[model samples]
Target: MPAKRTALIALLAGALYLVVGVTATDSLLPAGARGGDTTTTARTDTGLVRGTRTATHTVYQGIPYAGPPKGAHRWAAPRPVRPWAGVRDATRPGPLCPQVASAYADVASLEEDCLVLNVTTGASAAARGHAPVLVWIHGDGAVGGGAYFDARRLADRGLVVVTVNYRLGVFGGFSYPGLEGSGTFALQDQQAALRWVRRNAAAFGGDPGNVTVAGSSFGAAAISGHLTSPGARGLFHRAVLASGEGMMDMPAGAMGEGVPAYPHYTWRTGQESRDTGVEMTSSLGCAGPDPRRALRCLRALPVKKVLEVPDIMNAFQAFAYGNEVLPELPEAALGQGRFLRVPLMSGATLDEHRLFVGMAHDAIGSPFTAGQYARALVTAFGRDAETVGARYPVTAFPSPALAWSTVVTDRMWARGTYAQATAFGRRTPTYAYEFADRDAPMYLPLPGAFDFGAYHAGDTPYVFEDPDAQKYFTDAQVRLSDTITDYWAQFARTGTPNRPGLVRWPRFEPGGAVPHTQSLGPDRIGPVDYAGEHRLDFWRRLAGQGTSPAPRPTEGKEQMS
Candidate 1:
């Protein structure tokens, strides 16, 4: 118990560093409410009462959906929070979940006790009737992200908006033999939040039955997981997966000692993976005199030291398949038609991997030369390296980096999105799109030396109104935001995303153009079949024969520092 408390303290301190750096209102309430800034108090099924105000239209801040996950509860399923006796002050933002990333921390105000959600609604909805609900789950590569996203603009468009903060980093995902009692605590947190909405959204002027779960990047991937998880079924009627897919697993299979993992053909038991996780922690410096004590010690360590450990950052290391919450891999389950048949909207950006590669290049001090770029592809492709390089030759591309980013992005995100639509569209309603807005502002602070292009995560601000990034958008971005908000609202109200004044987005049929897709940019909202043009034919060929091409690392292959 002491060990667990130590972990909690360490996590709290780390979260404090991130949250305290940016926000002035440290906790949920400010020292004093601004005079004349409209505020309304509402009660929930739980004991707690919260306050809402007109931040543009109507915004509800710091509403608790679950109890604080601290002490023994730290690694357990999220419990329902106790309601308050009177109107609780909620004019300030809540603490974000414990995480190491400073970017999300500064905005979310991270804390070990953080499990609150914010809501925004249109004034017209309160005057009229309950509005359709749009619950947004954030994406920060599954490590750090929360609902610091401002959704007032969308609420102003006649919809009820919700943004939630979930557990992140080790607090949310880490699983080991010593921690078997707490498997997939982060996912459990999400489930509890969704259930809370089902029971309590009506009080916030939202339709409990008409709910849409949407997200970008890791948030989108989480939506995919939620749509497939049994515990999450019926919580949300519709989903929007922006720049994320469930099929992009590292090595695409579960691994054990002496077992080489392969895509779609390997599976392992939870007990076995728990054993593997123990072994992993030991190698990653969790080797105290008492092995169990080591877990406690690691938890107590500084956040920077934890993130500095390279193994923790690896994608494959983050998500393991043994837990009851995620008993099976999303891709394998989807392949066997084991997912809930919910209507979905999924797609990618024009240059999804460009941002990642650009970060690598700037860190390494040089752009990837044509040959080195091909070599990197070969390195990733392994035995089938040569064939892969030939398929996406650097010479054929305008730049080696561009060619490499194109191939990686297609395989990791775009192709997988297409595959998800192709397979799921067979039995469910699906809408696919590619966010091609070149002028869309990169939401985070990008290095001036880096050229991330219209990369991954750029579409987030479009969904949530960002004050800083909005200034860069052309008039077209404004129109696209309205169109997207309307489409999303309509999807929540109905199973389909069809709305007036926009291009008619059709439902996915086998081998047919989905109408929901738009080539969003400076004034273009036309039918864009980029999936077809990219020769999904080539991608299919690679996947049908699971082998990576050989590496011919070119002169200036990029590398992360």
Candidate 2:
């Protein structure tokens, strides 16, 4: 019976292929019609792409996989792009989502219409036939990130690399009573892009089945979200989550819990986050008194004004643990062995949170003294902070700030990621590594005194093989790009990242010898596991409990006499 079913499906596929009748690449024009330009390429789905000869490979830019989510469509599940009457320009990058004003803001111009992706592949390599695909999801605290991630180096390594831009901030993630049944829209967009790949990758000379989704920091967190999102099933075969995941269980009220906690914000009760999203929208100046009418007004507002209020938009970054989309807290789900089981490679940088804590230092008051920092550790981890601290003491670290940063990093990323990899690896194959390169550039500004050694998001340039990244590393740093790309490509092709001529990557089994994880930076090779110094016993003890201390009586700003 199974054989018959397979034969039937194959017959149907063949018939469908015949009916399609050698149509132009999915979104491109006919071959000869494209001026018969050899440098201009033709494929099945992505259409005719004109590639520019580069030092390493030809590059394709600004391909749209989904329609822009703007105006009335804001916050809706991403929609497929309308078929164009003519071949769309397959040159230059599209705009990126609105980002915080910064040096990188102009990597691609900011705009509402930014659902685009870029691909770079070696001309000679792709000419040989199918190549592996690598889709990158950038992390920007879940607020701002773009698709300018360079892939020329990775492409030179013989992979077809794609980077995507999705909606961000309130426009991309807003939830409200009016927008019911759609809290994970951004994640939905990612899955949509993956589906597009499965259908169109062949046109670009890529193997859709061999695709790997990779990201750093919040991008890593999104990778974790995808691991659990039902919508993401089968979109990609393997994942690389660098320095972030959705597993950290912070209080819902803190940091919007990565999504809105409407109840804590409004007196209204019993409304789902999306339901309350309507109320929050009006509070942010979307017009109309009636909540439903207000959402329409919101839909009509200019994207500029909407983005002007970022504090309001970032509210829905978190997904409800009970929502059908998310199902459960990431850690809880992973521990119970209920997550989407797939081959995964994930890890954190040496000092993942130095950037976060540094940004909020003034607000946190003067740096905590060694003793005070220890006490705060207990507050965060209960008795485990002591044991963890003993293992990673201020005495051992270069400074108190270093010790504090390590604790936070372990709790938020390293240990959580390790525990996640170990737990999920039990049922499925898992490979784990630690990015121990000390001289990795901190993507965000870290005060000079902090010495953000191998801080969060440092691996992106190396993975994307951004050429300008040379400013950050020496000739040795550039080679790390080749090494890391090779490891990633091997993993995407098979379940394991092992390849000849590179460091042997080990499966993440409990109590097994540590895998020599790829270290990318000033010195880009070697393996190290700092988990022992982190004292997992302490963190595990406080794992399920709430971390907030007793509510303290507080004075309002401008205290009344």
lDDT of 1: 0.62
Model 1 regions lying over 4 Å from their true place: 1-35, 101-110, 141-145, 178-183, 250-276, 279-317, 362-364, 443-445, 448-451, 513-517, 545-561
Residues 250-355 of candidate 1 have per-residue lDDT tens digits of 3310111122333422123455545544554555566755756766665666445555543342222134454566667777776555677677787778877776
Task: Estimate TM-scores for all models.
Answer: 0.82, 0.78
**Model 2 clash number:** 16
User: What TM-score does prediction 1 earn?
Assistant: 0.82
Q: In model 1, how many backbone clashes occur? A: 25
* Cα lDDT tens digits for candidate 2, 194-305: 8888887777778887888987655666777677667677788778877665555432212211222222121112245555365445455765557577777777876656
Error of 1 at 531 (Å): 3.1
All models: lDDT? 0.62, 0.58
Return the top candidate by lDDT: 1
**Model 2 weakest 10-residue run by lDDT:** 1-10
